[model samples]
Target: MMKRVLVFVFTSWAVLHVRAQSFSEVTNLLDSPTVGVFAVGTSIIDVNSDGLLDLYRFQGTFLQQPDGSFLESSGDIGFKNEDGSTAEGSTVFGAIFGDYDNDGYVDAFFEDLTAGSRLFRNRGDGSFYQANQETGIEIFSALQGSVWADFDNDGLLDLFVGGDGDPSGLFLNNGDDTFENASANVGYSPFRNVYGVAAADFDNDGDIDIYLSSCSQFAAASRNMLFRNDGQAGFTDIAPSLGLDDDRGGWAVVWADVNNDGWLDLFVANQPVSGAGIESRPGFNRMYINDGAGGFTDMAP
Candidate 1:
């Protein structure tokens, strides 16, 4: 029965005719002067609670109009610092939205490189106020990627931030509006040169495990790390037992049930570094099939 439906869909898709759509240049709609600036991170959310999705660039926020257009409104919405100034000459990498306070409104977190990270509490009226000082999650590091998950199973979202040179941190949510630094206590302090972070329950342990993609310029070799949750707040390094000890430079990572076996497999995107160009010798990506017994086998040849 499913095979007939699949054959019908394939035949219909093969015979369907579609026209290529053309997009018009609408650069003049945005009024912000820093539109062409180097934007590294972006997040789309209904910042105003007006049922319209808004765009958040590294420079500022853009509110969507009723006509499906965007207008820059960060300067008017109190996204500036306490001194009423904007961040300049700093690198912003990741932007994430969540209801950290459980106030029924989504807040924003912007990870910066030179300066510390920033968290903006949504005012529920289209405005926002910087709440990093009150939250205590701000850290001065070269931040790269941010991931949110309930690592402790406390019914609150915790934050995991990846960065360079002793910059990775795990901020455990205090269930209030604040967070506590739990990286060192949780056995994640040794990972210094992390770039990307992801969370999953690879062993089906009900608690989420962490995966970090790390690389360093000073080291001759680098490998990714996987930390299994200890059911407490601490973690145990399980990558070596899982046969993930490759010294390749890894960036992004994700997990999915690729083989329909109800076990989540791992995928790591790698890149070359230190005079190794793609044309000279390309770096191969990796995929690891989970053995459902707390181990992984590299399926990439």
Candidate 2:
């Protein structure tokens, strides 16, 4: 099924060659204004609601562009500020697109390493406006990954931020174009340097919970942490009993029911950041198939 999805996605791109371009070969479309390192785009979205997924990219430095090849304004592109500026020092990592405000328009969120994160409210047109201060999930210095879920069962979306620093956060949607931080009280503080976070209602509890990939000072080959939402205030750490915190160099993660047993399984990609050959190819992506028991076993091979 996953193979078919990948083939269909690539074949559809080949069919709509003009509108859909793969991120692996997008150097020509980029407008090089400043020094930057362009990695392959890891996420895609239609920020303008034009039915075409715009590339959400991370260039080591910033750049400029002329706007062609089905590319829009590179909306909300980051700019380097002077020494005393608010955004003076930071590198943007990843971007996710969603209709966060229930306004029927897809918006954008960005994760930066050195500075604070950004939430761009879609203006219903082609452009976007930054509402970081307005949304209240702003941070000073941390690497972040943004994920969305209807956390409180409020029919509105909330955000979870996985950080490279301790005490990763959760931002609840206030239903009024604003957000509230609820992580510290929810057992998400003292996070021990989290990396990637993915949310799902794994226990059929109707309340969204979280699973995180953590890399900290204590965690050399980091652990995959899990948080269970208890419907009232805070969450409980449930990774140890479920056998998900094995600490095997876990980095990026995604969860799905591979066997369709009504239980969501997990898949984690690992790249050793502390030991030898950290920048090599063919890193391992381990699959954890749910056995309907309380524990999980690695099924990658």
Candidate 3:
């Protein structure tokens, strides 16, 4: 069993690890020794506005001490509890941090597989309250991952929750601490197993677009989707025309300027035999190069 979580501090070049074996065991720095090792996921945020970054481990939370140590205070802050009770069931697929309410406090959004999807609002006192039902995002699905983006350019971050085999949903910010199921109203319902949901201004059109990494074997469903942002809460699928319709077991997608060409490009990670895939097909990674005209060309073979 994994007894400790290893953490590395990269000091030198991002391309090369100048130091050999720079990892240090943080099993003793955490308050809950068991959770420090068992926590498979984590996020960093300053919940207390103390200028120090705190940690949100899947099992609980850890606040950074002045001396650089960590203290687990999930129960006290209301993010997690001793009984590990969540919104519904105990299985958490993932969690994201965002100040959805514009209250200057970073809130948390969790995606659970069995009706446990919840939005925990930070009360500014190092505590959180479940605001799912009040926010109209008490959604449930065979979830995988989630992302926060300002789809409407309303200065409020919206949410996009992905699913595996189940269709995904996009909740738009209502500017009143509530979210509306814009996917249902806008007819952008995507029924596929989505592993990753990435957002960026790929076209530099001042509006954010979305790239969905999906896993499927069927010809019609296997290809991933790239939704172009058309102003005023509208989106159009332009993945096929851009040649980014990869039909393989997909997992993750990221945007970067790999060649420093002043334009954003995309990199997609795939699995030849993914667990979420329907059929076994040898797949390769794809790097989509932007043509500076809001178009993409798959430069990878």
In terms of TM-score, the best-performing candidate is 3
**TM-score, prediction 2:** 0.75
Candidate 3 residue 159 Cα shift, in angstroms, is 1.4
Q: What is the C-alpha RMSD of each candidate to the true structure, in Å?
A: 6.2, 6.5, 7.2
Model 2, 215-281: lDDT tens per residue?
Answer: 5434443667888888653588888887778565567788777665666788887665444644223
* Candidate 1 lDDT tens digits, 101-179: 7788888877776777777888887778888789897777777777888888998888888867654788999988889
TM-score against truth, every candidate: 0.80, 0.75, 0.84
The order by descending lDDT is 3, 1, 2
| Residue ranges of candidate 1 with Cα displaced over 4 Å | 1-36, 81-89, 218-221, 276-282
Ranking 2 against 3 by lDDT, winner: 3
Give the residue spans of candidate 3 off by over 4 A: 1-28, 34-38, 82-89, 217-219, 274-278, 299-301
| Better by TM-score, candidate 2 or 1 | 1
Clashing pairs in 1: none
The residue pairs that clash in candidate 3, if any, are 165-193
